[model samples]
Target: MNTTEIFLIAMLIIFSLPWLVWRVFNTDYFAPLVVVQIIMGILLGPGVLGKWSPEYYQFVFTPAVVQSLNGIAWWAVMLFVMIAGVELDLAQAWKHRRESGITAGLALGSPLLLGCGAALVLLQFPGWMGPLAQHWQFVLGIGMACAVTALPILILLMEKLEILRHPLGQRILRYASLDDIAIWGVLALILMDWSRIGKQVVFLIAFVLLGWGFRRLMAWLQERDRWYVALIWLAACGFGADWAGLHYMVGAFLAGAIMDAHWFDQDRLDQLRHHVLLVMMPVFFLSTGLRTNWAVGGAEVFAAAALLLFVSVAGKLIGVRIAGRVLGWGPGEASVIGWLLQTKALIMIIFANILLDKQVITSETFTALLLMAVASTMLTVPVVAPRMSAHR
Candidate 1:
């Protein structure tokens, strides 16, 4: 719609070439690909590019660019969900479902309590959000987002470091998948802006039933190569949730959980991950960096950031360890597995972004949490991956 948008578009295309080239040549530093794209977005964003020549920047920031970039980001998320769904060893995961479920619940619950405990005292702000923040719902959400470990980054780290098949990796993967869903469900509960408990219950029943039926039909059809049928299911799951007052991620996660890919094929899932990471994900990260407003979110945000990062990492590690001990796990084994599973990724980012976009979170909150995620991703991934591999 504006000149600034147009310039950003041209620049994104120009920048994407180098990113794509680098992706093919070397996959060594995939994390930095996200960093680089964000930097590009910031440079082209209001402060630098727009400041230099407002008119020129406006040309770059056209309506077309806005629409296209947003579309690409959405596509990346779909790929992320598909990969997540496809890789799941549902049968194995379900067989160990009790252990997995316990680990997941504790892993989610502990961080949630810790983050909310910190937020109540430290993350104080005034005015409109304060009312919402005062409620347990906001506290629950911020806590969950703060505590999530990135599943995608963990998989990448475990693979690159040659630890994916290790005992520690296996244990962590089993627990993390369960934990990811548990945490998401908790958020879904918080997100259901209903006035009464009965209303919420009704909504859940309708949502789950619709989701189950849709997924069953999808599996039946897709087993027969019916992608057109798959598309209808996708629309139902996605738009259906939008209509029902839930996030698309809920529907997407439900879709993944229900389609229930069997574990006989690992290579196809791996290929799917490769295709998504190489082609589409940079756009998502680009959108992340562009949406972020680091300039205004300075000193105050960092304090909250430090707390969120620490609480998130520590609580999950401790909770998982506690669960392991309860299940008669060895201390060293539990520690390694706990540490390995705590790395967070795209789902975490999207959750935080959703809150931010809904105006439920401040820009400062969003920026700090997101950047902390990037940092935590960098830190925890390398450490646990190597340790897990050696232990195996």
Candidate 2:
């Protein structure tokens, strides 16, 4: 079959499957929104029936499709990041500074610490197929992914539930935002310091100054002028990473952060995010699902994957619970935050991308991680939602 036929079929499944899931499952609990999309991928992916007929996998998940999926996924991620960054209105959460501190510590620190601890332990296992720690950079990348929280989704969920403007809501937003900042810092540091560049401190300062200057320059432009300017500068930053000793994501993130700081309006950014959700984001999720080489499945690997998943969930529960108590939340509230915020999606993509780029983790492992992410997000929201009223 021609590429066009393959692409069209992939598109059909991408658009149709979500609606089908909504129809199939009378409710969205076990068969959640994201899970349905993921299953769409598994249905076409190397996991189940695809193994019998590799031709189907090839037709649907072609290189062209893969590239297109990457494009959509990146845009979805960009919209998600911009939304997360702009909504971090420190002014609104300022009153909850004390409680925010407690929540932030327990919320962010516990996961990060546990993740790092797990990474250290996992490092000893010659090669888990999940990592290729030629350098600690790869190890740190996985650890960072584990530590991250879904801030944008968390905020949207909180707002949907109408707790965003309340005191607990404000505290949760602030705490989550703080966690995002911490996650960004860890991400930046990982991307930045990865190069064994000489004069590392000098490079770090210059990168920040460059980012700052770019932000100021964009802020100085007309709104229409700014998008073009931002586009050009981001292109330049991409080239800068290729030319200099820096990662492309560092430049991409800085570009986003700068716009987030000054030029982009939250409402406008969110509206763009709306387009992203409808098309780009679904393409992205579907792409990841197809790429999930679950043909690498086995009882042994399943055992390993389960251990990793359990450690991830339990560590967050224990660590965040302690952190919640420290942050001034009652045990009940902290337990909820620990369970809810531990939902990992965006980081799954980032880590998978990093491994794919670095050749650190295999396609199979990336797929497994995606499965873990979808499962966590599927479980987190419903479990946390009913409790929203309970907590109140």
lDDT of 1 by residue, 213-316 (tens): 76666656534353355445555566555556666656666656555555224666577677777677766765665565545444655666787788878887
**lDDT, candidates in the order shown:** 0.65, 0.62
Candidate 1 lDDT at 145 equals 78
Best by lDDT: 1
lDDT (10s digit) by residue, model 2, range 1-392:
77677777877878887867767775465445555665666566666546778876676778886787777676566555544555565654567677666666666665556656665665565444444335565556556566667765565556556776677666666776776667767655554534556544554566688878877777677887876676676666545553454545545555565555346665666676566566666776676666556444555345545555665677667766776656555647876777767777664565556565556666655665666666666677677777766776
Cα displacement (Å) at residue 296, model 2: 5.0
For model 1, the local distance difference test gives 0.65
Report how far off residue 372 is in candidate 1 (Å).
1.4
Off by over 4 Å in 2: 26-32, 89-98, 120-132, 188-207, 222-235, 242-246, 260-265
